[model samples]
Structures are given as C-alpha cells and as structure tokens.
Target: MSSALVRNPGDGTNFRYYTNVIEQVVSNAETGGLATVTRSIARPDQAPPLHTHSREDESWIILSGRVRFWVGSTSLDECDVHEAEPGAFVYGPRSVPHTYQAITSTAELLIICNPGAIEGYFHEAGAADTRSDASHSLMEEYGFVIHGNPPPAPQTY
Candidate 1:
C-alpha cells in the first residue's frame, strides 16, 4: 500500500553533477520502483556524454531556457538533432543513444525515468567525494552504456 507524497519546491535531495544542479524530486524507494523524477538546472558546458540506458526509458520536460538533443536509433554518429524550448517535452526510449546540451544560458528540465533506478546513479555520481573514475564505473553499474561525447551545440542558439 502507498500513501500520497508531496514535496514542496526545493524540498528534495539536491546535489551537483559536474556543472549541473540536480534535485531528486521523487525517488524509487518512495514509489516501489515504478519511477523516479529529477529536476536539473544545466548550463551549456554541462552537456552529458552520448549514452543509452539499458534498463529504463527517459523523458524530459523543459522548464526554462532551451536544450538541444541528439537522438539515435543505434549509433551516436547517426542521430537527429532537435532544439527544444521551454514547455517542450522529449522522450528517449530504452537502448536509444541520446544526449542533450543546454543551448541557452541555462536550462531547467524535469527528467522522469521509468522503473526508477537511475536516481541511485545520480545520487552516487553527485556525491561530494565521488571521483571521475568512480563516476564512469557507476554509470556502467547503473546500466548506462556510454557511446561517445555529446554533439556540438547548434550555432543558432
């Protein structure tokens, strides 16, 4: 049995991953592994490496600024780039290589993952004492396959 959970703004577990601020709004433990939601404020330099999730599907709701995403069916080299503005929503299915870069000065996004385990990776990788090498291993341990670096940001931004 589950009860209702309410989290006020800025009332969740917060951490910094690289140059981005990530807040775990709803964790897997609270939802019995159904899903997890995280809010992130990212800058252009905070773009993630091209990667694919083996265990979960991910969706993002743009809250502010703009973001450019590269999504591919199989390989990182073959991807379609899309620029999304605030109020846009993007979905990346499991095993699809994808990565995003903030195109504006700053971008705020709400990320949701199904089957809810990615938050553990976020928590571990964002830990104050975590090292770069350990962060790489944590991605693998958390079922993420790294393909390569993110694509260059669009000049139109």
Candidate 2:
C-alpha cells in the first residue's frame, strides 16, 4: 500500500462471496501486523452461516443500513440476536459461533479481522462459497468452522 499515496477510492477487488460482495480494502499482506479490512456490500437477506474462528477475533462496524446478527457460544438454540444500525459495532472473539444478515435493502459493513488471517480465505475460497457450510478441509485451511450452513448457492460464487 505504501507504493501509492492511496488506493483509488473505487479501486478495490470485489469478491462475490455467498450473496454479498466483499470489497477488499486492506489486505493482510498490506497490514503487516494490523488487521485486514473488508467492505461488505450486501442486500437484504444476505448472510453468512453460524461459524467460529480458532485464531483471529472478528470485528464488524456497520457503515450503513441495518444488519441483524447473533453472537455467542450457546449455539442457535440459545444466542443473542441483535439489530445493528449505521455506525454500530459488533465484536466476535475467537471460538465463538456467530452469523449475521443484512436486514435492509443496502447494508454496508466494515469487517476487520485481527491478526490478519482470514483475508487469504476470502481470496482463495473459490468454489467453497457454493454451500453455506465450509468444508472440513476449507475450515482447517482457514482456521474457521461452520457450525451450520447458511444457505446453498452456486459453489463458484
């Protein structure tokens, strides 16, 4: 990133993951020891599955629109669901199962992965996005597990 004064405002790689578009802003390679930042552009109903990471903590900063989320250890049977508006912030520590969905027509989330690990998964998860659930191999590779699948779409999403 130091090579340029700044990344062009509209110059981020957009990866279609699940039913949403994740525009990578700051890659793990760029952050050194900092977190990787991604801009999640989502439509209503788009969401990730209940999953957990064994290493890095996840941070979500709602930039616009509304998002509904569940985060905790009790699993889906018992978990805290929350409604987040613009400027809201949510944190998921390592080992916690969490999931979230966009509740508005347009929801933008600034996602930060501390210790900068999951960024590579976003780039390399080519055909794994088809099913909401991450395969065991994929989970092992990314250090995350899908407690339950989110929904099924084309694997190549």
Tens-digit lDDT string for candidate 2 (20-71):
5678887888878567988877664456778899889999999888887778
Tell me model 2's lDDT, rounded to 2 decimals: 0.75
lDDT of 1 at 136: 72
lDDT of 1 by residue, 89-118 (tens): 999999999999888888889999998988
Q: Single out the weakest 10-residue window by summed lDDT for candidate 2.
A: 148-157
TM-score of 1: 0.87
List runs of model 1 lying over 4 Å from the truth. Answer: 73-77, 127-129, 132-135, 153-157
For model 2, give the RMSD to the true fold: 5.1
